[model samples]
Target: MNSEARNQHVGKVTHHELKQTLGTWQLWGIAVGLVISGEYFGWSYGWASAGTLGFVITAVFIAAMYTTFIFSFTELTTSIPHAGGPFAYARHAFGPTGGYLAGAATLVEFVFAPPAIALAIGAYLHVQFPGLEPKHAAMGAYLVFMALNIVGVQIAAAFELCVTLLAIFELLVFMGVVSPGFQWTNFTKGGWSGADTFSMGSFHGMFAAIPFAIWFFLAIEGVAMAAEEAKNPKRSIPIAYVTGILTLVVLAIGVMVFAGAAGDWTKLSNINDPLPQAMKFIVGEHSGWMHMLVWLGLFGLVASFHGIILGYSRQIFALARAGFLPEWLAKVHPRFKTPHRAILAGGVVGIAAIYSDELIQFGGQTLTANIVTMSVFGAIVMYIISMLALFKLRRSDPNMERPFRAPLFPFFPAFALVAAVICLATMAYFNFLVAIVFAIFLALGYVYFLLTRHQRETAPTDALLEE
Candidate 1:
């Protein structure tokens, strides 16, 4: 087949539609549910790089960045509500090249995140059941949640709400259970990695800790991807985005402070099951409270695992519907009204990532850190592009209807852009291998686009419901 013929045939392909059934609360559920697992694990790695006080400093800075970014991002989402999320914003601002990069970065961010979360889920299960291999358990989790998402968005979102609520309740219960053991001295001890005062090494550690601190609220922006499925995105997107960030900020700070105060803090620094481990300091290793935490805490991981799968699938569908990826992936199940092909495609990549990490060793480093760093690399790229899109749109399309304008305007987005650049540079320096791998993936995506550019140009773009 000639290139022009292939392009014409691709243009003739039909696109399936996503159903709109989500309301404000459901949107909040998905946003919070997507990131709630950060409370359960991942953040502890910050302490491994920086001490307690150092990690706290990093956390505060990251929290500020997210606060500013979320506000600015909400404006773009409401103004151009689409499942493409960052891709749509960049497309409107910069054209196909920019759109392709933004979409690829988002795909990297959402696609890589689940494998890391899946490992944590396996760790939680392993803590409860000694016989369960973490890898096997992680694969099982991928199968179950991907199936749940494939069933339907409403059912998936409803499940997310229930599990997110349970996860929040468990966090509260953990604080109450461990409050008696909390001591100020424990948190402050070894605060600067045993140094009497801060030094250049401490400063570097703070920078290196950015990705782990990011884990606390990494995929919160994913809420914007649900805009197409949202009943009234203009109103509900802003409400859900704002409320969800506030909720996560509170949980992130609460878990960090309380978990540190409850024990040596160093012990849980790099562990997969930080919450249950910290609880052990208060209620002995075999205590009933600890057991309850181990079992219930699994819900936190499940919530995020399930919610993020929903996020990545929508992103995949959006990209395919717009011809950035294969159009067949944009197809929805007639009965379920879900993007089953996209959901399954993302699941295959996630599950493969898990096995690849286990079976293949890289630079003598653990799989979890590499995967997490790769995801952070994608996130930082997305942040930079998305923030730039906000600025470009304001100047390029002043008359655009913005139901929710970012309060500080240019300052907020500028701050986020700078912060994202710093974080990206820091991660590249500290995790050169993962950064290289991410760059390679991105380059390959561009190459693929170049080879298939004709098809995208000829393809019908109106099929996607970009509001």
Candidate 2:
């Protein structure tokens, strides 16, 4: 065979397939776990930007976008059912360049998100144990979760379900505990997005609050990453995505609203531990309920952190398999049948990100907030590309067997696309520095992608046949 033909063939690669151990419920666990952290924190930052009433409007709009996006995105997930998620969808709909863009964006969203969650995990731990260092705790979390993921998908999903359930229960408990203190007036205090009324300032705060509202549902699409390992993805993915989005919408609104009502919402608006802080206002800082929230709340953060590890690993494996990344990173564990190297690779990056607080600075924002915005930037980009792929595929591959067609057809996807564009523009406008850094990150990856094309093109199709 010619060198070009040789590069396109594969013969020695072991089957890179993951075991089909995920069911509808496990998929739901993953779907919920991937975003439950948003309920615990992050969204409150919107309040700081827009005020309680302003963030309220922003959250409702964001929730609508996510609702529409998930309904449409399910079509891609079930139709393609690939580990690469958006990358695979874009590749099938467009081509290699599209695949490269989606894959690179997925890496940014999945990889960067975990570090922010990890730091939150560390800070949560610090509240209970003043002796433990937050950074060390963050690094330790990466080690533990990465090991769990590398061991097996079933093990990882099960843990995700348990933590996710606990996390959900804790949110419910929080709303209930603080219910008596909830005053409608408190929610509207200094209302209109941060000002007393809707003004130029409110408009600015409203747009600036977009990313924080997005944080509420940011990584939920990551469920698409685990689609391949799902049992009967057509059926399970539909159930998981639909139910999961609804579950999250309720929790996000409830948590945000109740947290606002229980105390001075402004106090919770800018902090990482908003729930705990809000609870303390009602139950007293030294109260047992406040203490429980601080501890059990860790489950919410853990769920997202752990779930994203699973997500980023799968994206790495998929990109590697398609020769977008180093092919060796595609290997499935011989015994565990998991993407071991991919998991570890993402872990190292996340750990480094967790420690880069002093080494890197951007736009005078806290490292965690900046990281959250960075993750949101990647997610919105991926969302726009995924929706474009949906539109293109409907025309290009009309006969493709779609198990779950997006309801409302063009309308749903169109709404998602518009919302995503608004989000990306607003985020970049407000966070010019972080946006530049994010663009630089993607550009560097694209350069490496271009330089490595020859080797990747030459990779053997050895693993494809096994699959």
Q: Which candidate's lDDT is highest?
A: 2
- Model 2 stretches astray by more than 4 angstroms: 1-13, 460-467
The per-prediction CA RMSD against the true structure, in angstroms, equals 2.8, 2.2
List TM-score per model, in order.
0.95, 0.96
**Which tens-of-lDDT digit does each residue in 1-467 have in candidate 1?**
57876566556443466899999999999999999998888898888878889998999999999999999999999998888899989988898889999999999999989998998788767866889999899999999988998898999999999999999999999999999999989998888754546777899778878888999999999988888899999999999999999999999999999999998888998787789889989999899988788788888889888998998998998888777899789888988888999999999998898989554347567887778778888889999999999999899889889999998878999999999999998988888877888898999999998888866755554433233
Model 2 TM-score on a 0 to 1 scale: 0.96
Task: Give the lDDT of residue 357 in candidate 2.
Answer: 79
* Residue pairs with backbone overlap in model 2: 7-458, 9-460, 9-461, 10-460, 10-461, 10-462, 11-462, 50-193, 50-194, 54-193
> In model 1, which runs have C-alpha deviations exceeding 4 angstroms?
1-14, 358-360, 463-467
lDDT of 2 by residue, 260-325 (tens): 888788888767888888888788988988878877988999999999999999999999988889
Candidate 2 positional error at 426, Å: 0.7
